[model samples]
Target chain A: MKQKIRIGSGAGFSGDRIEPALILAEKGELDYLVLECLAERTIALAQKEKLANPELGYDPLLEKRLIGLLPLLARKKIRLITNMGAANPIAAAKKVREMLVKAGLNLKIATVTGDDVLEKLDLNELSLEGNKAIKNYPEIISANAYLGHEGILEALQNEAQIIITGRVADPSLFLAPMIHEFGWDTQNFDLLGKGTVIGHLMECAGQITGGYFADPLKKPVPGMETLGHPFADIFPDGKAIISKVNGTGGVVNLQTVKEQLLYEVINPFQYLTPDVAADFTTVKLHDLQNDRVEIRDGTGNKRPETLKVSIGYLAYFKGEGEISYAGTGAFERAKLAEEIIVKRIGNQFSEFRTDLLGINSLHKSTFGQDTIPYEIRLRVAGKARSIEDAKLIGEEVEALYTNGPAAGGGVIKRASEIIGIVSVLMNRKKINTQVTYL
Target chain B: MKLLEIAHSRAGDKGNISTLSLIPYEEKNYQLLCEKVSIEKVAAHLKNIANGKIERFELPHISSLLFVCHDALETGVTTSLALDSHGKTLSSALLEMEI
Candidate 1:
């Protein structure tokens, strides 16, 4: 049996930086490198692209990422796992196969599918968000149920070096490797829970490596521009050490790990995934003092019978326009511009909002700051039923340069259809998962 | 004293809910954070952005506090018209609270 296995995180979200991932594949002596690229709203956008072209639904950066890492991944014999398959895994795997052939590098690839459950969905089912029936939503785009590590594990067991999946739980992308390496039993909830904790910590790539934890003077980080990604060295007992590449820009300490522990998490006691109800509260962290932290004591119970499905539908069109004002009474001019735009097209859309960017735009609450800024930007946004109606908002704001506010410069306008995403629970047995090798 | 002096935070969003983690710079200040930072106080501080139920989860081992606010992101990021739809800045806003 191997003493330990090292796993490095490549990408956190869909648009994360690509250079740091290359650094991991080259320097980090990793057995497995997992790139978690999908976010909650990512697949929904991919679905729109798929509707336009059958083979274009996968992540746009799939080719770029593979082009850069395939040589190193092959040379290092490091297995790659990712949900870059977004809305379509088959096409993504095919693209990777083509790249492998062109580069004269022979690598096994596996594609996992069947997460899409639109036809299997019952319109009468209530959404977990607002308790509204699925039928009430119009223009449904896609519905993908979050799968577990079973699919990826099957591919790994089959000796597939590259595993591509659609809409699997983010942490499962990292957890599957542990199960495959250690030959862990499916029913071992405690081990699975500990593995899940490791997955959660490494899933966000740079977040735990001090990308989001930096502050000037208070919490100073050395290299903001070249922040390195993190990796976990896991033992057979499921205990792991979190660390980053040596001489890297970021720091992996107790605070960064603690912040990431509760990120997007409501209750630390029970963090529900498809594999296990992992308990984060029971987990413990130890700062090793040199960009390394030993984490242990993770536990969990059984997995849930139901799976969470993300449902995407067309909600409304949003239009926005912005113009800047500077020097001597700039705030007053911006306020006047907001008033003029609100009076012209305020009653047209269902929701209209006007704000001065330097003022109360971010937190709509009034804290009453002591000083007033000499420069401000007027922003007007509204939601409408049709694209044409939404365009009117920007057009009116543009008219201000010629008619309403004085010295209104740098006018910008945007109008796009908003895709509203919600979630619903589905029986795990109802969704069938399949894996195919390329 | 401002909460920023003792603690730092990061914001995350799921659906219409916003989750923030407040971790003290020193473990000794964890008790002070627990005493001063309450769900009611947090809801009052962010009354403009979030109006739904507020719940706090404690991780004494790590000496951190997590606050979950529902109906927070103005109907979530996909549909919300707010400039900061994901409520990413809400973490800094929460740090402005006086202790």
Candidate 2:
């Protein structure tokens, strides 16, 4: 009899840096371990690296993390799936193999690619649909598709304990085994969509369980140190429970599960998928027992005729400077200082763009939040299309220390310029994903 | 068959929405959607049944539609949907998406 398994990937904050998540599979107790090391900025970071090294689009930091765990995974022999490879899975796989060989651990790794149709695409032919206010750029920095769990199935078939991929749609890491184990077919679109929805719920590991959804009211899941990974227990009949590493501090109850289910769905029922669109809105969330929720009623739907392309490029050459203005009129003074400096900087180097971000959304997002009155600091940043333009803009902001306004004002303290970037805007399309698997 | 189901899902911590994956219409039915069906009719039907204010997102590339019933988020249930009061149309609605 095929046994049911529950596995969760590991992710935690260690002081100033984040530790790798794949380590949870090393416990010798998990069927699958998911790692989410890539974010929007991380995508841009990989693109920046590719500019320096043509074949280095995949983030090396994530690769370094994955490589470090090979020996432990091999020793324990755990099967896995991950989207650590940002753009090119093959290139990323080579790096992983190199790391494995260096560490004296031999492991089979597979790459899933062909998700990025951004470069060869013509934006004129695509539609933003109802989503407006989004801008499109002339060039693409990085474009990749969301390959579903098919890669994991192939890896398991080849006895590969670890599967590395460019950008497998997040849900497939959790759904692959279920499909393979249940003998579900590609034509079984409805069930496949359900499994995909289940995978989507657990992919974020912590976000769905309790890490992000813990109500601000209750004494939420405490002691996040040694946070547990997320896993699912799927039955042959088509229902599952999402859980995390045992004894891990988190709850997988109704609120948590529903939150996960809703994450990233622009629409509840017509949720698009590479394999099949899932009717997530129709689904039911049942608190089956302790720390468990049963999600049902999701009907499989058709995927969008277009694939979403996440494009990135240069925003400009940007520089940042931070400073403090204490006492009675600190906020007002800071606001004025920002406006004057921006206008002055614009006057100084008219060819660039200036963006000023303060701690309002960061420090505290809502009312009733109290920031120290006298400690308010005014920070300024400038970005331009050209390096010289950016430099001139930077010089303009720095000029505040000398001839600019607030130079000798009370608490006109500190500042510095930051590096700028050329921002890339992405457009999406729906086409039959073409792949020649080797 | 062309169908769109609009509902919300979580993206991260705060409630971000999710897209419900619906089965799409077929090859020969392309011209029929624009000529026969109207976005207003679908939006009206969904708005009447759903709980919260219906949020609608239209599409491009194809002449299809995405009608989301935005008002359902407040009900606080594991699963929720507002079925149209006219019960005879469900089979036709499923046929629209070709489910």
Candidate 3:
């Protein structure tokens, strides 16, 4: 049995920095590099793309990322895992195969499916608002349940070098490798929970490695321009050391790890994942020498009986317009512009919002009547039922330059459809994972 | 003193709920933070942006306090009209609180 396994985080999201991933793959001396790319809304967008082109539902950067990492990965014998197969794992695996063939490198690829439970779901059985059935909304685009580590462990058992999955729990990507390498039992909830905590900490990549933990003098990090990615050294006992690659920029300390440990978490005592109900209240972090933090004692209970499913639907068309004003009572001019735009489009769109930037845009209730600034930007945004109606908001804001507010410049407008997300609980037996190797 | 002097924070969002973690840089300040950073003070400080219920969880082992503010991200990330729909900047805003 291996004493320890090192797993590096390549990408936190779909659009994360690629250079850091390259550095990790080349120099991190990692056994596995996991890239978590899918967000709650990404799958819905991918599903929309798939509706247009049947073979194009994965992440757009999948091909480029594979091309950049394949040669090094093949030479180093390092395994890769990712959820970049946003809506289509099969098609994504095929694309990876094509890239490998062109590079003349031989590597086994495994794709995990069965997360997409749209067809099997009963909308009438699910509720959105209080007692409101999902069937009432006729515009759901995609629905995928969060899978566990069983499929990923199966892929590793098949000796697949690269594993692709759709909508698996983010922590499962890291936990599966540990379970595979250490031969841990599937029912070991405490160890799974411990591994899940590590996955949650490292899933965001730079966030836990001083990328997001930087302040001017309070918490300054060196080499912010070239922040390094994070990696974890896990042992058979479920304890691990979190650190970054050698000669990297970011700092790994107890603060960074603690902040990430509770990031997006509601109740620390009950962090429910598909594999285990992990508890973070008792997890301990010790600051070691040379930017390493040792994490230990993460406890867990049995996994939840039902898995959480992310459902995305076509919400509405959003229209936004911005106009700036500067010098000689700019706040008054921006306020006038806001009033004018609202007067022109307010009756048409009830969901409209107008803000005087640099003033009460972000925290309006507290800073609403604060001191006026010398310069301000007027922004008007609203949701409309149709694109044409949404475009009217921007048109009115642009018209303020010539007709309403004097010295109004830098008019910008945008209109796009918004995707809405909702969550539902599904029985574990309803969703069955299958793996395809190439 | 400013909260940033002794603690650092990171914010995350799930649907309309936004969570921010406040971890003390020195273990000695954890008790000070627990006493000064009350849910009422947080709600009062952030009364402008987040008008929802705020729940605080204490993790003494890590010397951190996690605050989960419900309905805090306007209408959530995908549908919110704000430039930062995920409420990522809320951490900085929370750091501006005085203790």
Candidate 4:
């Protein structure tokens, strides 16, 4: 008899919708549910929160997600894996324990820590961005290595019902269970590579579905508002089928799968996660009509010698302001408003830019025909050394209503500190992982 | 004809680089994409936004072309002051290229 496991993706990012995950838990009949919530700069901001309050630092919506899915997951006997423990896995695990007690469930939870390699990071190492020494960077906030599946595999071996981790590579969260359930060899690069292909495809829940694929007249998607996330049915032979829950709002086909296969990927022949150098070149996707796609033949080479570390540091404060102009001369008025801000405070900030919302904000450069519109919104933003200096850029833009342009209404302004992220490769031997049962 | 007529795209980011995937509506168009959508043309197309090198990779089986535009997303999503710091719209711009 062929053994198979069903895995569903709940939340794709930190701020993704809760309903899709609830739908998955309620209907997907999943063996494992994985929620990947961390982004590149998410933990650095969380580290700041942890510094302010010791009990803080996890995903803001972790409690809500558990409250929504725990009972359903418990009833279905679905194991859950998440990287929602952004900067503090221990604290996150404790919170989950409290939630389990409150829900009257006796699920064993585990926390995978030691992704925080801040102390272990060699300051002399060069950053992948500019090749600058780590010590030369400004006030460092967080340094986390992209951990593989070892810690997660350990948690599964300990019979954990729920595993929470910080800084585990997104694909690894999905790949760990395949290794645990199938008892696949650790050095089985081909199997791990196949698993990684599945992980990367499912990592963004709605992406492999129709969420990111719709174009007005060209490509049409059915139920975007109620778009259901995706799931995979895996076999012991390293083959998987990608699909979404039936009666959902999205389409799952070869197109969606292919788009996501290359999502955030540079080299398809060598997609390097912490686990394996997955080769998407040999992968084949067959759309089995009615929302089922069969994925086959994906393999990988040996894993990278070093793991990539995401280091966050306090960069600068960004101040921005936007105001609208209307009527026949709206374009000229918006242009004048932009000029006023530049002349007033351009020299105060290190970097500054102005964009007319409908005109050139996205591309930052003009493309297509130049036509004067009835309404245009002028946005002025700048990078400042300090918060106070950052505020000046917005202030100047807001002043245009009374001081510079006519009908510059709907003024909005904001200033926030920026946390910049850089990467450096560290020896995989240096990352000391620990898994603790909660 | 606009590349958008026969193909679709999605933009992705890692650090300062932007990755844009161009998949044709029909597999037959893959050859046209290979001939028209050269790295030089893409670099020229995104010259203003991405002031860096552009590399292209071909996926013959899938009939897709992946463009890795280096130094494209300003400094990065977190640090870049651009409204579209992730360069999510870069793919749309790529689709606007002539086929």
For candidate 1, give the DockQ.
0.86
Off by over 4 Å in 1: none
lDDT of 2 at A189: 69
Instruction: List ranges where model 2 is wrong by over 4 Å.
Output: A1-3, A11-23, A40-48, A123-136, A214-219, A288-290, A346-372, A379-383, A391-438, B1-99
Q: TM-score of each candidate?
A: 0.99, 0.69, 0.97, 0.98
The digit string of per-residue lDDT tens for model 4 on B60-93 reads 8788889988888888888888988898888888
- In candidate 2, position B21 carries an lDDT of 21
Candidate RMSDs in order: 1.0, 12.5, 1.5, 1.1
- Report the lDDT tens digits of candidate 2 across residue range A1-438: 355665565542111123324435644266666665554435555666777887787756655566556666776666656666666566677777777788887777766666665556544443232132223543345555555666577766776666666655666667777777778776676887778777777766776657765533432665466555566777765577766555666677765665456554566556665667877655666677666777665668655544445444443454445555556766665676678776666554423332223334121121233564664555544434556655554454555566644532432222222211121223234433333223
> Candidate 4 docking category?
high
DockQ score for candidate 2: 0.08
Query: What are the chain B TM-scores of all models?
Result: 0.98, 0.36, 0.98, 0.96
Measured against the native two-chain assembly using Cα atoms, what DockQ does each of the candidate structures obtain, in the order listed? 0.86, 0.08, 0.73, 0.81
| Strongest candidate by lDDT | 1
Of the two candidates 2 and 3, the one with more favorable lDDT, higher being better, is 3
For A3-99, candidate 3 gives per-residue lDDT tens digits of: 9999999899999988888899999999999999999899999999988988899999998787889998999989999999989988999999999
TM-score-sorted candidate list, best first:
1, 4, 3, 2
lDDT by residue (A1-438, candidate 4, tens digit) is 339999999988999989999999999999999999999999999999999999999999999888988899889999999999999988999998899899898899999999999999999989999899999999999999999999999999899999999999999998999999998997999999999999999999998889988776988999899999999999987899999999999999878988999999988889998899999988888889999999998899999989999999999999999999889988988888888788888787888988899889998655675776678998888988899988887787777767967878999999999999999999999989999998
**Residue range A1-438, candidate 1, lDDT tens digits:** 687999999899889999888999999999999999998878998999998999889999998887989999999999999999999999899999999999999999999999999899999999998799999998899999999999999999999999999999999998999999998898999999999999999999999999988988678888979999999999989999999888778999999999898889977888999999999998899999999999998888899999999999999999999999999988888988988888889999999999888788998754656466877888999999999999999899899989967899999999998999988999999999999998
Which structure among the candidates has the greatest DockQ?
1
Instruction: Give each model's clash number.
Output: 0, 66, 0, 0
Comparison by lDDT, 1 against 3, better one: 1
